[model samples]
Target: MHTRYGSINREMLIKRSPGWRWIDWEELSHYRDLLYFLTIRGIRARYAQSVMGVSWAIIQPLATTLIFTVVFGNFAKLSSDGAPYLLFSFLAILPWTYFSSTITDASVSLVQNSLLITKVYFPRMFIPLASALGKWLDFSIGLLVLVVLLFYFKAAPGWELIFLPILLIILFIVSVALGLLFSAMSVQYRDVKHAMPFIIQLLMYLAPVVYSTHTIPLAWQKWYVLNPMVGVVEGFRAIFLHHPMPWNWITTGCGVSIVLFILSAAYFRRMERGFADMA
Candidate 1:
């Protein structure tokens, strides 16, 4: 059927493709407004009824930073790579918080929207994609706290600051990649919702969030960088904490994220055919 907006006319075609189908870029672009609305809706739904609302974004990382400072910095004496332990942990926590929270919401996105999924023909990918996008509001607010820390420490990022956006983009892709995989799987198996928090908790220890990469044994460092967040968290410190950029880790992690995104997108599309039935 044809949809008319003002004088412009657009046709949306719906049909079944027999085999596995990849993302329909053009089709998604046509539905861009839906993605925007969903993203906004998610942001509002998360903060609407809360008393503190957006302030929770600033509080979460600060609270985590305080706990880590007391336990790891004071007692255990974990290396913060020479920066103040508080700033170091907060920088890592900023991205990690975004990554974890996005995944948590995205994983159950399809299941939560089962009614819409069963009734609609839009790209299912948007559900998780919107979740990822919505969490950036929290991340952006957290950045303000990061700036305050930067000023308090009198630390300045040198030329390496230019790479921050690239690092964040890679981080975003990593979140979306896993989000797609888990969101699709959760539609078929309700257990994914239960297991996700535990998985994300374990993943935090795997990444160099509370400690520096220097703690990793030299021999295992190469293999450890394969986890994308290792690079992202380390890169975040390198830029904000004024440490040397770890290009090897960052490049390796970026490559892994890209490959994972392709595989996850393929799997999500392959499973898309059954989402309405299963959801």
Candidate 2:
């Protein structure tokens, strides 16, 4: 059978390669608005009916900081690297909370938004990325509380403050990478949803969130930097508590984060082709 348009009749065959690319940047860009809306929707859904609303962000880190002050600061006698114990613990908790929360949400973002996944053709990566974005707003609010603590303590960041944004980007990279990897896996195995919080809780102790890295033996320091958040939590305290930048930890951690991001992106891409079907 032949169909004619105007004066011409033609038959065309279209084909797509069997293999998928790590990312379709152009395709994602076309859906940027969708990403923004998803992020906004997430934030709203979180606080829409809450009594405390956005204040929950501040309360979470603040409450954790208070507990850590009693448990680690007074009882354990861990040094705060110069700043008061409250500021130090909160700074560490700041990034740690952001990282943990983002990862937790991203891990289940695909499952939570199964309806959207089933109905959409956009980049599946957006689900995890949008999950991260929602948490960034909470992080920003918690950061303001940190600044208030700094002023209350009469503390200010040194020249190393210039590296604050870079450190946050590194934190974001690692969190998003883990989020992508786990979110994809969760689509196939529902257990990731249940275990994610416990995993984050265990990671908090291992990553130097409640104590300075100075206490860890020098011999084990390099091996400890293998946890990317070792760079993030410590780097956060270094900048916020007005201490020297730990170049060794930061560099190694950043490198590891980049590598993980690349690997996770590839893995997510491979798994995402079946996401809508699985979801």
Q: Which candidate tops TM-score?
A: 1
Clashes of each: 0, 0
lDDT of each: 0.93, 0.88
Tens-digit per-residue lDDT, 1-279, candidate 1: 343432355654567866677788977888999999999999999999999999999999899999999999999999998889999999899999999999999999999999999997898999999999999999999988999988998987778999999899999999999999999999998999999989999999999999999999999999999999999999999998778899999999999999999999999999999898889
| Prediction 2 TM-score vs. true | 0.92
How does each model score on TM-score? 0.94, 0.92
Residue 217 error, candidate 2, Å? 1.1
Residues 1-279, model 2: lDDT tens digits? 232222255654445435556787866877889999989999999999899999999999999999999999999989887678998899889999999999988999899889988986778999999999999999999989988998899988878888888899999999999999999999999999889879988988898888889889999988999888988888888776666788889999999999999999998998887888898
* Alpha-carbon runs more than 4 Å astray in model 2: 1-20
